[model samples]
Target: MDSLFLVLPLLLSASFPHFTSAHNTAPPPCHFQAIFNFGDSNSDTGGLSAAFGQAAPPNGETFFHRPVGRYCDGRLVVDFIAKSLGLPYLSAFLDALGSNFSHGANFATAGSTIRPQNTTLHQSGFSPISLNVQWYEFNDFQRRSKIIRERGGVFRDLLPKEDAFSRGLYTFDIGQNDLTSGYFLNMTPGEVKAYIPDVISQFIAVIKDLYNHGARSFWIHNTGPAGCLPYVLTKVPVTAGQIDKYGCASPFNEVARHFNVKLKSAVAKLRRSLPKAALTYVDIYSIKLNLFQNATRHGFEHPLRACCGHGGKYNWNKDHGCGSTVTVKGRQVVVGKSCKDPSKAVVWDGVHFTEAANKFIFDRIVNGDYSDPPVPLRFACYRH
Candidate 1:
């Protein structure tokens, strides 16, 4: 595990120097020259700091040698997905230092919602950037890409609007925050259930926006087991019986499944409208659930607890969240604490997954084991 701290930084630094220089990578058999991602922190490579502020420490301490704006301790699921497809890790389009637009640009933000003014979440200060804003940002990115293509810029000189975009894979890993935030706003399970159709409509709208721009390859990840998350458990009342054998809140997980059912149906509707598009809905919830069931076999000792955080049953104290600060002994101290080994834990910071978990999930999705229609991204992108 100690080797992770040493080896990962060297590997990442040696490869991603393009924030300051030009670079190019040959497309794999998938024929996807690039990836353009849009969502929340679940798949945000660095959208937080790129457009807003930075992610605090313990966030990337496990691997990247620093916080790279991902909510996790290291790489996100999108990072692993890119690697699986033999592509460079995607860069946030809003990154001020410059991201490698050649491989792809991420438009996801940490606190994004599917709606522009989702009243429940918005009232609770949870709606920082919505999917609506992300689409607008994508439009701006397309504009910039066009200018760069026309001018024959310093980076990825061969990529033009049609050459790179037409063959690129567009991925989304969002909607978890949109649902979870409703609980914080005091919305009941019934209320939350009623709101699923709105979420589906918004997702369809975003997909249509991308389809109009010549994008045909789509890999969309459904929300994972949010009820199983350690931090979320702290937010609500529960009985011992309510906790499942896997240590997740049964009622909350049911809500997630319910949402997925509606979302999956919506994907079917989208397919009928955009028949030529390759839309693969990945079942992230099942992938994560199976991982929880086989945690010991997968090298995770504490699958329910976070690798970083403080003072809670799951090590995710709400009063002292991961990367937060508190005054201790007349000095400012980081409130959260990190585990002895992060690679052995599935959860990170109570809410997000550890790098190890995200990699496992990505592997399952790419392998066709966890994706709906049993189609892997390799074949899905080729159809486009």
Candidate 2:
């Protein structure tokens, strides 16, 4: 008995290092079969200005060499998330221009928001497909996938169990435009705050509704620091010496933080209410802050200024936009200039992040030790 006890302890000691190492290792990569994205320009793949002639440049110029409707030069958060999950880049659902749905489709539109009234710099009217409408489009995709499967088509086997409740990832990155709309409409910040909770409630309800429709894993982004955005800063100017250390408008950033807090609480409530649902909050505010703090580390000279547009001091004017003409040093030159390499820049346009910034945010989400109570959506359905 004495000999056996000693051997047992030795065996445990021998295995202890291995066990510790295993525990310290990163979790296995999440293998998502499909990625469904719904949101505004931040996550939009290409769901705006296609029907109309209006276009934004430096948008999709990095990859597709032409405007692809995405508000950035290339690849938004949705694209990065999809790529991280080893899925194909999501195509725009409105892009009947193409017929590929193997990976998934992006239903996000530039200027789309959870609230009904949303606008952009161009004053482009609100998205044709609102949040509710995007949900309907998602349902349509599922229905079409089902029909294809019933026909024993190529994607038949790709569909998750219609009733098995296998969770797929759904990303929501809206609401900035809602606040922007309110601000543009001359509504007080307090009035905007009053109306935001209901917007959040409606958002949560839609997410829960999606859960009923077989979505089990949800990743929702809290609003980014909106006051820091060039458009807002320029439109709603502060006193000459009142800029924060970050050069952001304090009131607007405070509103954004307020929304993020409420959103975090809402997500927590969601986890409690739906024990089986794995919902995670992507802390975009923190990510944005980190990017700003480490701008030089990321190769950005000016985190606040954009690379494109005239004056070359701030962002290009909303009316003139990037890639337009202006006078520079007595020479008439095309004012909107794209950087030699966009990957190094923090802000691609006046509003959105560069593709590199988006990639960094994705890395932070997957790798950062986030404190904001993650519900572990990837592990929710795993059986040890």
Query: Residue-wise lDDT of candidate 2 within 1-384, one digit each (tens)?
Result: 244334533333342333224434423435666777889888877666554443556667887788877767777777876766677787777775654665666788877878665444356445656798788888887777767768765555554345422446777889888787777677777888988898888888888888877777777788888877777777665675657887777778788888888888998888788766767677888888778767898666688887655553566577666667667889876657677788777887787888878877776665323424432334323221
Candidate 2 ranges with C-alpha deviation above 4 Å:
1-29, 53-56, 118-125, 149-165, 324-334, 374-384
Give per-model TM-scores: 0.87, 0.82
Overall local distance difference test of candidate 1:
0.77
Best by lDDT: 1
Provide backbone clash counts, one per model: 0, 2
- The TM-score between candidate 1 and the true structure equals 0.87
What would the per-residue lDDT of candidate 1 be over residues 255-299, giving only the tens digit for each residue? 889988888888878878986687888899998988887899987
Off by over 4 Å in 1: 1-28, 118-125, 155-161, 382-384
Q: Against the correct fold, how does model 2 do in TM-score?
A: 0.82
Q: Model 2: which residue pairs collide?
A: 60-73, 309-336
Q: Return the lDDT, model 1, position 295.
A: 97
Q: Rate the local accuracy (lDDT) of all candidates.
A: 0.77, 0.70
